[model samples]
Target chain A: MKIYHECLPCHLRTAVNSVMTMTEDESIISEVVEKCMQTASRFRSYDSLLEIYYDIQKVVKDAFPGMDPFSELKQNFNKLCMDSFDEYIKKINDSSDRFETALKLCLAGNSIDVMQGIKMNHDVLIKAIENALKQPLNKKVMEKLKSALQKSSNILFIGDNAGEIVFDRIFIDYINSEFNKAGHITYAVRGSAALNDVTIKDALMVGMDKSAKVITTGIDMPAAYLPYCSKEFNEAYDAADCIISKGQGNLEALLEENKNIFFLLKIKCNVIAKILDHKYKVDEVVIEAKTAS
Target chain B: MKIYHECLPCHLRTAVNSVMTMTEDESIISEVVEKCMQTASRFRSYDSLLEIYYDIQKVVKDAFPGMDPFSELKQNFNKLCMDSFDEYIKKINDSSDRFETALKLCLAGNSIDVMQGIKMNHDVLIKAIENALKQPLNKKVMEKLKSALQKSSNILFIGDNAGEIVFDRIFIDYINSEFNKAGHITYAVRGSAALNDVTIKDALMVGMDKSAKVITTGIDMPAAYLPYCSKEFNEAYDAADCIISKGQGNLEALLEENKNIFFLLKIKCNVIAKILDHKYKVDEVVIEAKTAS
Candidate 1:
């Protein structure tokens, strides 16, 4: 989760993807890319890679304010997933392994970011779902999550991206229906737009707040990096008995936190993938859930 | 040839590849990458894309002294081509169009840079050669080059990369033999190691200086940017009746120069690629040798 050598080029590519979509002005593109690099160069050795991207995001925001460069992309992705929501729900409803299906569905959702390798299409989604269903989850951790959920009255589900949130809604609904804790769930998003991560508007659009109380991390970091979060999110993080941390970003920021947490995400980069000993490309998903002492 | 928006990300990737090979130390890697970014950021808007890379290269050299990060890669490519070079020559000799074959071989060689898309191997080289032969040259320009070579005695041939220089030697030899100007050729290289560009030592290694007087641009810029060239190179460039500019770097720098320059290279990027209306992605070769009347 700390800065890796490979992270440098990756940061440049991300900024390039952002500015490329933002404007066609060559000068602005050059300046924006340089600004991102210069800003990242100032990051301390202890700073997480998440902070580096967050700072770069600021450079883009400052250059062109109030315009979400990924707005159209996010909307398109949301619609793409939502268009098949009912069919997917019916498929899950009829499936023998609803929990496993929902968990895999959540993992497949993390594979939506354009900057990342995952392509956004229905076939790609179906492929990911099939792959995840066949791929074994960490059985011990899954058992632990199920065991914890049996007694837990309150839960916090930290969601990842915009379109991905639609999948999370399905899983959360499944969790509430199967485990029967509908009214007690708290869903968290970023305080503002961070990469393709969801905000309040996206959550509302997808009606993610329909079943659970929606909250913000308030830190604006890509993941829910807690040290910078507002008092409310931190209190919520402390109060939740079972926490479902979505995406690699949350896993990075909250890996060693003294709380009950489950990291449900796709291993996107080699650095973290190596750490997990996950010998798969960005196409693979993993589920690791641990309980509080 | 001017700086393009697409060029920003590419420059970062080049620096990343350089630093990745230079050292494994993450801190140093991060530092060097940032330095390259800062160095490239300082380049004036009017500077060609090649200058951006040249400056970034300086950053790498400063960090790692007396070592060409691409030295091993360059040598491997040279040896790879040189291993089958005799066979290639035989094929060219057997062909009815020795000049065209040699010219395509040279273009195929241009595909050798790792930063650029050419994979290092005989198969890739052979494939490139086949594609070049089948693909039609700018016929009008090729005819003009033939006419210029017949009328003019002295030609300045600017070489590009180290491995690609081997192919350049073959084409130059064909020019010398066919045009009966064997002693009238001067092959120019960079004064210092700029990326994978050939220096006098590399030229000598490939025996390029043996047939012709091998000279330096006397400038550390990526290509023959004559504004910074030594007095000797400028005189040679000025006096030559025809100039054969190899590689996109040379094309970017020499495009607007008022000289009878034959730009023999592949369009590597979208910015220049779009301008040429070149439909292929980094695989096609372009022959644009215009005589200054």
Candidate 2:
């Protein structure tokens, strides 16, 4: 019920569109837009995002017609927005909201700006409650969620996407309504839009604060752009009640990290779909780590 | 000087826009008319064209807001058309003309209807010719091209996308002009639109008759849609001294077929890009294969 990574696309689209609007040179903008579009198109391919972007000169040319040098940075930046958004949407639409919430909780750590953003979106958060009333809760997912709710005094929830935040709120409300004795949940947003980057502002836009504590990461993480990890993310990652990872980038980064994390997302790429032994249609998924004895 | 794929977008935009007034769908028609507002939001994710029809559930929801299925489909179909046009623009603008042409050529093996659809678009082909004239020829490709022109007494040239046929014409024209010995270059097109389908009509739409012989594939092959192996295509594929294949689909179907083919296209997928060790970008790519001789 907790909406996690589903809210990512609107934020990503907003950022890219904002950048597209601000870029002054038509040729460069066009080139950059094309690069971003090409990057976006490759999401349908069965390749890693890194492999997709690897030596992407030919693809860039396909996207941008007449190109010069200065447009390269802009193109890469535009690609950042698109790549992140694609993964964010994939995760949010097809996965259990629990891991999504867990991801947000992990990011929030203790950032107040992030929390305030979630708080402001209370009205939006309630929209999910209305939707929840309409949708029959799946017995299996609900059982795991209820158990997690029972075990944790402080549950960290990761957030994704914009519109789906309303849906995510339903999960938290359900916990509060039916299991008030469980614990307080901390919601986390991305420090910046790294693949699954969700901000407190985004959390507010979708109304996350109406039911939970919210926060953000303390540093800017770029693995979302490139595949390598940084020191800051590793330390911040180590401190969490439970880490919920959203979207492909987060999943790729954390998939082998051996952390106590739950992954929730839609399998968008053939590579991931192959990994999950699923087809390309959107579907919800959830994975929880065995609690440390 | 020869206009390559670089000149394809402007030419295609003009062609599609010219007929934008004639499209049956009002919304898609209107979207085509919007000079600068095209988006990929409409047609990006469908696995097949059939899905376009089945997507009525959400169409009614978002387009009609609170409307029922019937009313929403009625309203949204119009919107869908515009969205389709938008997606077309995105595809054309973002992809290299050469690559697009290659895709179209590969598609020609899909179905005769797809081939005919390409033939129907005359306006874009004319514009493509004008654009190709503006660019200098790639010497390396041109050399191989020149040799093909001389060595082959008869040629089988594959056609690609809407705007790309003009570039194909450049090769055909050069071959005839320089060699002056071949009977004619037989241009082949797709039978359907599965991924990358081209057809004879597409060859003619770009005025293939003016420069070479036009032929249609007999069978509809999704993974390898080539009519050449058929009675109709084999006659042409066999009679021709050499064969020219365009697009990724062709490469997918033909690359390992152990046939004699000079493949012309921009490497569009990771599989090929990785094989070539080239960064994925839109550029002229010519791969030569001899039939294990």
Candidate 3:
């Protein structure tokens, strides 16, 4: 989706947060924020928020070269999730509908976003996971997704963040093991670091390859912009019969695409909520499907 | 006080709010916001937030010429406060310490700021007034101000908003009638409309001239930037034995000035709170005095 007027302030906030993660020097932070403001001023209404965000990220990278500010936090979050993997798996297995429980778990994991400004500690994540399990999802949509998984031969899952990948792995494993009709599953991550988004290393560390083939989108931007994707990713995207797009970033990048995709995310901002016709509010879990055109 | 890094996002928010008050056209809002961002980018760390805000206001004015977007709201708020004027005066009269009670009401009226993002309705203002009266003020500072008022021959009262001036007039009236030692009183408003601030017309409309000599700062900025003030205002400010600087804007503009000024305001943002050495939080009543150098 194109940038909304509200997105400019959000972009500035993100720019400030991103720079703050790298340094504590007031002058440097001020300089980077000023540069980001300049960058934001140059943007037109037609620009996607992801594109604008990418440019802001570039400004931060230019200031602090060779530094992934979120790396340590990402690793800490991954370990936190990894420690809870067994408990989540047991809960899913004990649930009445394992598939639905696993899906909710994946949505719960979406709350571990560093850029969302909510302090994401272990206690907060646990509370979110508990809430997500009890939170209502559209029954019709869940049934539709289940039927699609049963019928589709090829599945592609686009991952979002570091800690979220662990839950995605659990969900993918459930589908791969139980759904005989579900064929080859391909998992896609961002080519490089983008706001704690999972890369090939995170996927490998989480042992996602045990359930599905792991690949990168070859675009450093947070979202899967089709034009910038690697040839291999495009081939996989085209070949897949069912695609699971995760998080607000991917939802924004592919919201207008003519593809058979199911968006599973926790809406985190008013911009996304408005784009979704105000059917969802921030902190609500969204399970929506878009038919192939 | 100089601008903090956190103030940049606030400036953008203020810019967006300012433009939004004028028009609903998305393109125009986006254009104006972008222009404000560009203007904000040019600000130095030494610049006051009031100066940054003034420049952003200029951008909005340049877009929508000859329009005072806040005029109608200002009038509505003034009437709202005027309707409750008798009741507020009764409350002060009923209190044992009428001077302190009147001063508390003045601080309570400071909650009617349009730029603070809190919806300023009659109900909200009433609640704020009730809370402000009950909220604590530093006893030492109050004692100092009372002692200062008793000795000062020339008193300068800087007015902030339209609705607020009524309350200020009540406080000034109480002081003038009750304190025999208190001397000539002067009330200063913004020369022109500056974000719903009290102007000459508002002062006259609210009968502020009855209690004190009404004058304008001759600068349209929300804060009283001393360098840009009219010769008349500067003379009044210099001659005054006690200057009552009202609201956060004026407090920010004159926080570092070596004057016998008592800042009577409700701290509205973390920037102001931090500048005051974290002794106050947002929405707290502040009665602080800065002695002459």
Which candidate leads in lDDT? 3
Q: What is the CAPRI rating of model 1's predicted complex?
A: acceptable
Please name the candidate that would achieve the greatest DockQ relative to the true structure: 3
The iRMS of the candidates, in order, is 2.7, 12.0, 1.3
Please write out the lDDT profile of model 3 over residues B40-101, one tens digit for every residue: 88877435667787888789889988788789888887888888888988999899988889
| Shift of residue A45 alpha carbon in model 3, Å | 9.5
> How many Å off is the CA of A73 in candidate 1?
1.7
- Would you give me the overall lDDT of model 3? 0.86
Give the clashing pairs for model 3: none
Candidate with better lDDT, 1 vs 3 = 3
Per-residue accuracy of model 3 over A1-293 as CA lDDT, tens digit each: 66676777777876787888889898898888889888888878435777887887789888988788888878888888888889999999999989899989988888667666567777888888999999999999999899998889889999999999999999998888888633478999999888889998889888887888889999877888887789999999999889999998899888898888999998987788989999988889879998897
Q: What DockQ does each listed candidate score? A: 0.30, 0.03, 0.56
Model 3 Cα interface RMS deviation (Å): 1.3
**Residue-level lDDT tens digits of model 2 in A41-93:** 33334234344332233344334344322223323322333333333434434
Misplaced by over 4 Å in model 2 are A1-24, A30-142, A181-183, A193-197, A219-239, A277-293, B1-293
| Residue B63 error, candidate 2, Å | 48
Q: What tens digits encode model 1's per-residue C-alpha lDDT throughout B166-232? A: 8888888887888888889999999987778888878888888777889999966668987778999
- Full candidate order by DockQ, most accurate first: 3, 1, 2
- Model 2 CAPRI rating: incorrect
